[model samples]
Target: MAQHALVTGSSHGLGAHLAARLAADGWKVTGLGRRPASETPGTPGVDHLQADLSRPETLERITDRLGEAPDLIVHNAVSYPPRPAHELSLAELEDVFRVNALVPYRLTLDLLAATPDTRFTSIVVINSESMFHADRDSGAYAASKAALRVLTGSLADACRSRNTAVATLLLGPLADPDKVAQLQRVAARRGVDEAEITRVFLRKSNPDLVIEELIDFDACYRSVQYLAGLGRAANGMLCRLDGGSAGSLI
Candidate 1:
């Protein structure tokens, strides 16, 4: 049988791309997300599980849906809205943290418990540069991602003896038009020009970012696959996929 891989947040965007790539590479891929596969288009060979990570009832029974524990679990699901720390409400913070950090932590435990001791697996946690660098507007999202980094480290420590390797990827800026548009909306709200907001965002998030060519899905997928194949050797590793820009920074 092909190596089984379970990817969270695979309904769309980066998660979906990664799922497709994995399936194409001969891995049996299962996608877990809130959206049903019928309503949301997915890769041809990928299986999807519809579950809202925020709901405890659904999360509690998620393991029941997977017939076999996955050899690779990709925690690609994320909840990030551009909000300042002072503006983020407690409810909103909890909701973001639940999806971003808590879900991965819970799923790791659940999957490990279901797995037999004879098998070794890998868990890849997708993160952003914000995990290490703080931003003024996106502070709340950064904090949650930072929390995820810590949790992944703890998991690496706890699961090493069980032959479960865990790693976190701190990615630099990607070519996301949606994120640019989100910043544009913020600029509108602040009565500032879009260019000014974009400039400031680049300055803070990735000062050396090559504006013409940001990280693409292909590069990101390559990183994920590389880390996934490393297995036990990569436990507790924090790999940076920032193209020598932010990764090299002090």
Candidate 2:
């Protein structure tokens, strides 16, 4: 049977890259996001749906788009608004929870419950470096992702007995265009030079193995596949995409 892959947040960043890579790997790929990934400049063998994961109805929208179940599922959409502790509002915090914690969780359980079969295979959740370690100002963003990491663990526990797969990929700061834009916005807001901001970011990203960090989407896919094939069902925990270090979790 042909492999069917579903990737959320495929309009850009690692999501887009993974979608394309899965297609190249000969899977029938479908993308879910607010924007359309199929309209992307040179992407072939990928289909997309305009489903905003922040909304409660999004999973249903995705299910409607799928028409039938897919074999592989990856949740990669992240919502990172300015999460200043002193000034952030209730709405902002709730939105962060909705997107970062609740939505992915709801989708995972609902999707898995709705889709029951070993043939369905793997489910991958994307967490961030911030998910493990907390920053003073990252209350909302970090808390939600931390919860997501917990849920990834929960799924691993629940699926392990059934011989299913659950994978968690903890990311460090990404160097994609959106991350650059976010950095620029931070610089503007803080009245700092863009170069200074870049320097700070790089310094903070220094790991024991810099070259091994910033793993490509193909590598990300392989990690998930490894976990899936292990029959352990509850394996493949990536604490920091920056060098795959356990230090980040501490």
Candidate 3:
């Protein structure tokens, strides 16, 4: 029987790439996202389910819809608000925490509750290096990710007896292909080079964000796959994907 995998935030970017790659590797893949796959033109072999992870009702329905327990579960959804911690509104803080930390916690618990005997083989959380390194502008985002990291560790402990390989891919900055393509289109319309556009975007957007350290989509796939494919021995592992910049001191 084919191993079934449930990947969240699969509408586009890294989630979409990972889901496609998993499907190609003969795993039965189901992708969950707020947007429908048809609108974004998702991978052919992977099944798509429309879901708003921030909504508890939607999450409950999704758990019910999942007939069989998935062998693997990938939590890749994130909510990033690039504002100072003091400037973040109550609504914004709530949103960031709900999507980044609460959703994954709720979803996993729901699955386990729905099927008491179901023991997931692997659980891969797409985390961020921001969790370790704090930024003045993106403090909320960093805090939320930090919460997720702690939650993932707690989950690892909870599932230790089940022999589930729970791991967090502590990713660095990523040059999302979807964002790049969109910028390319904008550049074409403005009759300017994409590099210039990228520079302006970096300047106006994330602070201290260097394009050089940004990992591509394929690298993320390899890291995620490596963690997911590991046996029980690799449980509670924190695999850092930063390009050796953070160093072993972390």
Candidate 4:
């Protein structure tokens, strides 16, 4: 049977790539996000479900809309301008956690409870390199990922007793991103040309197909997991390249 997979933050970036990759593997991929259709990534055959994971009220609807428990689930949402350590207001900190960490944590509980009878489901999470090394001025991002890493262990423990499978995809930096235009804008503001910015972006994208340090995995996915197939890259419909070490990956 084709495995059913759910990927959060599927509106773009890592979630988008995982959705496309899984679909290519013959799994039924579902993309979940709060963004409108225009903002969503174009992953053909992926069922897109948009619901704000932060709100408690929408969960029931999320469950209703998801239709069935997934065999695989990838938590890949991210936050930008990652939380600062000292000045992070309660809202500022919690806002990132709500999407990047907390929702994924809670959703795992719901997913497991909803599918109690299953012997195992392949679970994958997208974690940060920052969890290993602190990024400059991004303590909140590091903390959020670190907390999730702990939670991943906890959930793996919880599921180990239940015979469910879990894997974590730790990323050093994504080679590809959907924010080229935004990056270019920032470069312009800094009085730098866009070509120079492009060169800088390439250098920062991950050179390796996979890196061990950045992701936290209790188990592993034994395959080369590119976000999209060649057509997406060749035609330039979407830019899902990995980034150098300093990628805007959070």
RMSD of each: 4.3, 4.7, 3.7, 8.6
List the candidate 2 regions with Cα displacement exceeding 4 Å: 37-42, 118-120, 178-200, 205-218, 231-240, 244-250
The 10-residue segment with the lowest total lDDT in model 3: 205-214
Which of the numbered candidates is closest to the native, going by highest TM-score? Answer: 1
What TM-score quantifies how close candidate 1 is to the native fold?
0.85
Candidate 4 vs. true structure, TM-score: 0.70
Candidates in order, TM-scores: namely 0.85, 0.79, 0.83, 0.70
Task: Sort the predicted structures by lDDT, highest score first.
Answer: 1, 3, 2, 4
lDDT of 4 by residue, 1-250 (tens): 7768898878866567667777877989889987976787667878988877666576667766887888777787777544356777887777777777777888888887888554456566677656545655777788788888777777766764564655455555433443556666878898997767755654454343233222212121232243222211211111222233424453
| lDDT score of residue 70 within candidate 3 | 85
Q: Write the per-residue lDDT of candidate 3 for residues 1-250, one digit (tens) a residue.
A: 8998999998888888889999999999999888976764568778899887766577668876778878888999887775788898888788889889988977887665554444556889989877656767878988999899899899889877775777888886677876778888999999998879877875554454445434788898898888877877668998987754344577
Per-residue CA lDDT of model 1 for 1-250, tens digit only, reads: 8999999998887888889999999999999887887865667779999988867677888898888999999999988764677788888788789999998998899899999978988899998777666767777888888889889989999986888889988788775657877987999999998878876887665766655345678888998889888978889997887755554553
* Model 3, C-alpha of 171: deviation from truth (Å): 0.6
Instruction: Quote the lDDT for 242 in model 2.
Output: 53
Instruction: Pick the winner on lDDT between candidates 3 and 4.
Output: 3
Report the number of the highest-lDDT candidate.
1
TM-score of 2: 0.79
